[model samples]
Target: MSNKIPYVNILQSAICIPVSDEVPIALDIKILPDKNIPAESFFGVWLLDVSGSMGGDRLENAKESLIEQIGILPDGTIFNLITFESKVNEIIKDVKITNKSRQEIIKKIQGITERGTTSLYTALEKSLEILRKYSRTNGSLAIRKIILISDGEPTDVHVRSGEENDPNYQKYFMLAKEALEYKSSIDTVGALGEHNVYLMYEIAKLSTGKYIFAENEEELKTKMIIATEQTARIAFSSPTLAVTSITGDIELEDAAQYKPTVIRMPFEKINKRESKAYLRSFEAGDTYQILVKGKIFIDKNNIQTETNVKVLELDFDFGKDGLRETKEIFITFSSDSSKFKLNQDINRKYANVFSQAEEIADCTIRGDAAATQKIQGDETKKID
Candidate 1:
């Protein structure tokens, strides 16, 4: 294992697995930000919903939270703030925070009031536009994030009817796709349990971001801070893990991420023997665990011989930084069954992840949106 990389660490559940028809493997990867790195590398666009529903404590709390976030942001951090109701308003644009501008930004946030209906999609569209434009001059290494906070469903004519087929609703997903093009993830916070849960969840998932539910009005501030803090700690952007079967006969099957929120990850198959899993931005002091399943075909004649076999190779890619390191995994074949040992912790995690996945699927098929949201919310809380 190459340990030269100081920013990230990778750990596996077992160095060896029993040589059988199929074996499971798990990797616990931890990424730590270098404190010496400049904070200017982080860029954020915050979308605050000022729809009429946000008139009272909701709006006030949001303002306070935004102000608090601004106050705590390290000097030289680049951020933009936008508020939307029936119209999209850009309160600040491409502002790099410093001692002089911090107080000015807070005053602008405090002046925000609520009116009109929620233009959720419009707000998202505008924010992504700003980030996309900024990325052109600033480059891709910066940690780009969009934090959207809303207390109610979208009130746009095409989306308010709850029709998925509406062109505007489809456009919402397209916006998320566009976000990926700019290497930006949209983290969403559904405040007061009234926002469209499925919409918030899907957009965040599609963008490889987090979806947080502030169950009550008071929790919104905390959740917003949590989201901001996570983005602030991003050490590496667009991290991907590529697994290759070196032995040719070991067919890589499926993979899923079990930590930092349990959701099925899109496992891209490069070939029958190789696959890749794209992870969200890596944050300092945060660990991500992934479980990969594979099938190994042992030669009938060779199975009788006790030998060590090289099974898999992992290549870690850190966005614009390219492939940082590689690790190879091996397993042993032996006639003595006593040599076989199982990593119970990994097994349990695999079981729990798949179980939750199945429950989500069933809920979706039954058109139980509430149940699906509940399962997702419960899984998210587990990581907290």
Candidate 2:
């Protein structure tokens, strides 16, 4: 038997919806690489906050988690650890994990202590600098990720004194853009309830990464481990799905990802007939379902009573080996109501996504940061 396997499998819901002016569809994407294929080199940068706010249990738990994470990383994985307060300190440089170096890395992680104020922006900037330097040397095949754990907002004099319009505050956004350019995602962990959830969320979203909120010590450790494991399993990097209208005057209305992680995906309209959405890197064995809503302007006089109407063509661009896979989705238009059943699973996902979006907007309008964070975390967990 051949040991080779396809890099990805794209599946769409079998059931069709009722023919109307607007129709919604769901696509389930599975990324599976052959076990015989060599694993990509993993590059992970940890930006830990050791500010005064992260004292006692917070710091201790973070240290314990870091040590545990180091033990589980695969051999030959490049790791860097940087802890920041008023100043940033690089405890471990770009060192590859091996049986011997793993122990030394754990010792350095155990030695991390808390003091001074939070310098979140500075720490992030330094991490990106390192990632960019190594990415150029390693080429585009390496899997690069940054895990930022913070319990408070930036308290550095420059960041605090500057408003959002100031250069200091705007630098974070620039860093996120650079991370994207470097093919590195920044997964952010808000260590405690007091952390700046909005800022962390934006950073993660901008970099095509996940944002996790840890309410307590145990969650902090567990969530960090999950984030690291996901990064290490990445098999496909920076894939984008292009949706092109095939029949009639069809326009994409909305789109959101429902599985692996629950978040609204931003899409760009390329032209009147096509649109594109940027998807996250796919981990091996990972399945993602995206709910896409589109509007079709139908002329009832010219409509066929019983036929399969092709609506959209999905072109998935997997950023490796110049592989581009395409799939066409069709809906059955019938006069019999019995044959026009909707996929309940897809319907539920659509409802949940929009409901949560509305709730988050309400929370934001009322200036309820905690509530907004809670809604995001709860919705993501429920879907996961």
Candidate 3:
């Protein structure tokens, strides 16, 4: 019998990070051949503090970031929103990421009044409960986590700010522990230089997640972007296929999720190397197909003049696995030929993401909820 070598479909994971307002980075996270992800699915929890302290542009920026965050989410992310202050509110009770519901949710967010004392602990408790309602054990996806945005500590009488005053602190600690124990990432986004940044950091550490401090509205935008990128790295940076080529078509789509084609990835991390691979910027109209995406420019006009532009490209024979485990990949914007040439052997420079998918493939995607997987052994048992 002639031996046959089946063309193994080594699946890849993609993650899109929408920073507060910086360059949007979508990374192709590499994983081994064993872990294959399907087309599109996203799962996450958003826990925000709407206390009076988080008013004005701070709240506005948070909403903006939420839109960006939600915009890139694939149809699969069974996301739920938790906002808190004196009390906690669930904006969208475990809803899938969609245009209509997300718009309605954003409108609800717009009506959020920043009133009442900050109740960080209470918020955490209640939000955790809301998330629990959507937990994997309860039939939610496995690749899930929490995003906590706040600028203060809990005002709950039970918990102490420090180890010094009280037994109630232990209870609060347990509450935090329980939430994290359930395998959910807890990323913290705090106001830049706010006195409560320390608390945010502490919470991040407790949750084994990312801590991001945004100093201003602009930085908040950037931080939001960074936060999303970081999440992408963590969730999707696992791929086996190495990209032999990359090109950017200079395109601008409004923050709205509807009218544009999207790249969906599960998770992405920032501080780590090899996790940063993104589609570069190029205008399809400015340059034709063969030369549309391979060069870098300080200015758009440079394209016509064809000045000193940076060129990076990838040409690899990664065998069956497509991508290797290397920590870096170079960028290649389709070039115009006649003018500029390639520069220093540059690798896709990876950077820090202080802070952090779509669709319905209908199959088991990577990080999917095991609770949804049944049919195990000799006997019959239910999944979840």
TM-score of each: 0.80, 0.78, 0.49
Q: Which stretches of candidate 1 lie over 4 Å from their true place?
A: 1-41, 157-170, 249-254, 296-305, 320-323, 333-345, 357-384
Candidate that scores best on lDDT = 2
Clashes of each: 0, 0, 57
How high is the CA lDDT of each candidate model? 0.70, 0.72, 0.43
Residue-by-residue lDDT tens digits, candidate 2, 1-384: 112333555455534555566555555555554434344458889999999999999888888888888888888889999999999999998899899999999988888889999988889999998998887786533578888999887876344321334456456867886897887888888876777655676677677777777878888887787777767767766667898876556566456665655566677789877888777776665556667665656655555557777767888876665567787777777767777655566556667876776676465344344676666554224345
C-alpha RMSD for every candidate:
4.5, 4.8, 19.0
lDDT of 2 at 335: 66
Which of the numbered candidates is closest to the native, going by highest TM-score?
1
For 69-130, candidate 3 gives per-residue lDDT tens digits of 67666665676777887887777767776777677766766676677767777767776776
After superposition, the stretches of candidate 2 with alpha carbons farther than 4 Å from their true spots are 1-41, 157-171, 247-254, 296-310, 331-348, 360-383
* Prediction 1 global C-alpha lDDT: 0.70
lDDT of 1 by residue, 1-384 (tens): 111243545555554444555555665555554444333346788999999999998898888889888977867778799999999999999888899899899888889999999888889989888878887786544578888998887876345433445566567878886887788888888787677666776677678787777766678887787677667666666667788876555555445566655666666778778788767766654555566655655544444335666667888777655437787776665656767655667656667877886776565334345566566554234452
How many clashing residue pairs, candidate 3?
57
